[model samples]
Target: MPSEHESFNTRMAKAMNDRDFQAYEALLTDDYVGEYPQSGEVIHGPKNARAIIEYYPGTLPRDTLDLKSARVGATEARWVRTPTFTVVRAEGTGNVGFSAMQSRYPDGSTWWVINFYELRGGRLARSTTYFAPLFEAPEWRKPYVEQRGPTADR
Candidate 1:
């Protein structure tokens, strides 16, 4: 049998794939903090996170999220989950967004929103994105583009 943490991650991914915001909302804690890359804004609380998702562009079609790998620890664990988001516009233009979430399973199955989503367009418009990191620690979190560097100190 899979661990509860693994099960929770799977369920969360499924809910997202289904575009069932209500279900997604259920997974989140009351004080969820969602980090938006494009805006450099951190949305505090579950209510705010839901509002942000509501304005997300491109109607979500197929929401198949696969758990690639997971690194478990005593208190906290980081998992690499990839959710392939298929979006379709009114003009019939389809685009795919791959979101790589690094979730920290605190208190076993209870998950927190550490990082996610690089928004595009001006506030309310289409967003085309690729694999983005979801940092667990606030201090470790930086601009997604910054992570792609060939500098002296990587």
Candidate 2:
């Protein structure tokens, strides 16, 4: 069973993955700011945040049925939607939190997103996020590292 208590990052991940703008907005402060350093873009407030989500391009045309291992209690279910994003890791202390996420694009490519969050008055005050596409490790480093776990195939 999932815990009754969830960290800020965990809730943020669920809100983002579900594309629940209302829940996302509730997590932020009135003066919330978000930055994307790669594009030198900055979002000043929740209104812009909603605009960004509404304007994001290339969403999946429709959700697919989950043909594998989706169950409710002991019964199989096929209507569940596959998650487009996964929170690989997240942690926080005091008023600071950070999360690493894996995002799957409509182009069939995967990217990593790292987010640094700051909280004030128990809500998000600022965020800095970075995005980078997945790449194969250079052959030169083959001897120095070991392939491990689920990510080994990537």
Candidate 3:
């Protein structure tokens, strides 16, 4: 059985992977805030956070379910989209949580994303996310380090 913290992380990961904005919003506190330091953007409130994803230019992947069908209450299980993000890992203790993810974009690029979260009353009160494109390790560093696979434990 998953611990309370693990369950919370699982719910968060599921909401993000499904892009269920309504569900995502429900996981956040009314005063929730998120920051993207790379872009110098700050999202205030759950509604605005949802808007950021909903209105992102060409970012939303096309769902397998037809738009008309979706509007008619088609099951989400029938929905499919490409370039979805995968939660590499998530863990939490007390009021602090952390998640690492790998995102593949439609442009054939992959990026690593990390989010540090602060929870209040079991809902996200603050988050800071950082995104970085995957890059090949420099040959010079090979001698000094051991390569770790995706599932390698910290």
Candidate 4:
């Protein structure tokens, strides 16, 4: 059987993939913080967190996101996976992009995000995301970058 932490992380990932902000909000702590990497800006509280999700449509290509693996510690969980984003340009051009992200779940209730994405455009066009931690003083954790697969895995 999966642990409670693992189950929570799975549900969170599913909520993101489904774009169910309501469900996502339910999983968040009362005071949630959302971090955006491109601007290195942090959105504090659930209100800001909801705003970030609402405005997400304008930021990147929207597609079904898949959550691969999740690892949990005493009070934190890290999800490692690549999401396929279908990028759409204002000019009606569209393409698929893949980016790796590590989402930390504090208290198994809220999720703090740290993600890096590169669009077809230059570095300035890239996007970064950060979110609030569940604990009083959240520790600094590293982001998950994609690694080359072994021949057998490929």
Best by TM-score: 3
Error of 2 at 92 (Å): 1.8
lDDT of 2 by residue, 1-154 (tens): 3321136667776665566668878888988999999999999998788657644553222233222322111125322232356678776777787778887654556789899988888678999999988877677988999856344244
> How accurate locally is residue 85 in candidate 4, as Cα lDDT from 0 to 100?
23
Candidate 4 displacement at residue 57 in angstroms: 2.6
Per-residue lDDT of candidate 4, residues 44-124 (tens digit) = 655566556545522222343233333222213443232212211111112222233333322233333444322232111
Q: Over the full model, what C-alpha lDDT does candidate 1 score relative to the true structure?
A: 0.39
Counting clashing residue pairs in each candidate, in order, gives 1, 0, 0, 8
In candidate 2, position 135 carries an lDDT of 78
lDDT of 3: 0.71
Candidate 3 TM-score to native: 0.75
Location of the lowest summed lDDT over 10 successive residues in candidate 4: 84-93
Q: lDDT of candidate 2?
A: 0.68
Query: After superposition, which runs of candidate 4 have C-alpha atoms over 4 Å from their true positions?
Result: 35-38, 58-154
How high is each candidate's TM-score?
Answer: 0.39, 0.74, 0.75, 0.39
The full ranking of all candidates by lDDT, starting with the best, is 3, 2, 4, 1
Cα lDDT tens digits, model 1, 1-154, are 7433334445555565555667766666665555556557766765666655543443232333222333222224443322333221111112212333332232223222332222222111222222333333344466443454432212
Which candidate gets the maximum lDDT versus the true structure? 3
Model 1 lowest lDDT segment of ten: 88-97
